[model samples]
Target: MSAPSVPPQSDGGQSGRPGRKPGPISDGVGPTHRAWLEPLRTRFLAGGLTISDLSERSGWAKSKISELLRGAGLYPRWEITHGLLQVLEIPTWPMRRLWMAAALEAHKKPDWIDGCIQKVALTTGPVEPPLEHQAFTDLNRDAYTAYARVFLEDQEAFEAVQETFDLLWLHWHEALASSDVVAFAWPVLRERVMDRAYHSEDGHPELTHAAFNTLALSHLTDDDARFRQIAESLALFRAISRLPAPQLDVMVLTHLLGLDHAAVADVLGTPIAAVHSTDRYARKSLTTVLGPQHDPGDAPA
Candidate 1:
């Protein structure tokens, strides 16, 4: 089954534009996030579970609960969301895990990592401080889970996240030395995945089975254009994965990691020209695979 459809985040009032489209909240996944969370909000109201009840059960402040429900903060924390679920006597173990997974990703910037970055990024490199300079802060369950989801799927991913952070916990100072922690997250997480995939010798079944250069993929299904867009995105990602390693790496660094050409060149230890060439090839191949006149407007906003 498909996920629920979310209404536009804005009605274009803020932009003062008549026909401009609404944008996603973060990573262009706002619709999916709102779709799942909104229903829970509805249930909370329908069940007559007031702020006092949730506050009493969860031990979180009423203002915090109110802000979360109203979508006031960066993103709702999983613990808070889980607390609300328990207040409603809902079981979160098996079925709601997927929904919770999606909700948890919103926790990335909201939690510990964001604050530490400011302190660490200001410094040139690792430096000894007045015995009080902390090496690393803790990773919450939500952020830990999202890190693994960057690569792996299901139970193995969970285990990988646990093991990976435990190791990172060993060398926390290195993260503190990075020029940009936001940029650092992608590589650090992906390296853990690369290690796991290499050590265990697991094959990427998704890429082997996926097809991008097909007309059927290019054509939107009549039943639901929205759903078709989601399918196209999956296909596009898979196709990118199947590109030659250099091209794939460059494309992923540029688009997926939100890196600039200079950063890509730095990461890959390649010249700027190679970065440009690889990106050009990647785009041209994707455009061909997506078919002539394939509009990327349908992609996430």
Candidate 2:
């Protein structure tokens, strides 16, 4: 372990205050990250420590210390921030919360954050993730992955779910603070999946990619019949994707992911009634968009 940085002493070998404080944090530092940065700056100034002192004491480069103080350059990893906080005698618990909130705001992946924290060992001990977080991940990982797989390849879908869980873990406290954890966490998962979803020219997630892979097309042996099925399937996919988010989610969870209405309700943290209503709206809207079928039973399941 590194020796704690000592504040310069006064004329009588008493602790002396720094002559000047560090400059104001730039406006560019986001509010969440700035919240954490301010205390580090305040503690450093109060300790009468110089950049060189922090650098030497923490075993960090002088340039790194300067950037951290000035809020310049890329957002730093938790490992470096934690080390500096220790050297400055700041309580890690409070700053850890603030650091996490900032990290979430920075849009870092969970693995990236975890890898960074693991890089540096601290006497305070390794960071323990919240216990409920593990439970949450276990419960929802498969459902989220299944939903994501509708639009993404298997590995991409898995990665999207992984990122979502990581984000939820990072903001676990905030998620708990919200009216409903599902309400908060679902949007995070949805955003992660949609970010990697295929988008049409207007930037909406469109299912045009899934059109050719339908079971209906596989059953059609004639070239003309297959081509017609392809066209209708394309139209259906576009309609399904263009539905409002709630309706679209219900359709995907129920029809595409093979989850039941109760299961969809459970996953979305919504009432069964809401899921049923949304499903009705989605099917009705599809019917409206595609026009009434001569034989409703012939519609693709």
Candidate 1 all-Cα RMSD:
20.3
- Which ranges of candidate 2 are over 4 A from the true structure? 1-119, 122-128, 294-301
RMSD of each: 20.3, 10.1
User: TM-score of predicted model 2?
Assistant: 0.62
Worst 10 residues of 2 by lDDT: 1-10
Global lDDT of each candidate: 0.49, 0.72
Stretches of model 1 off by over 4 angstroms after superposition: 1-149, 153-191, 195-223, 294-301
Candidate of highest TM-score: 2
- lDDT string for model 1 (9-60, tens) is 2212433223212122233444335444554565555454467666887888
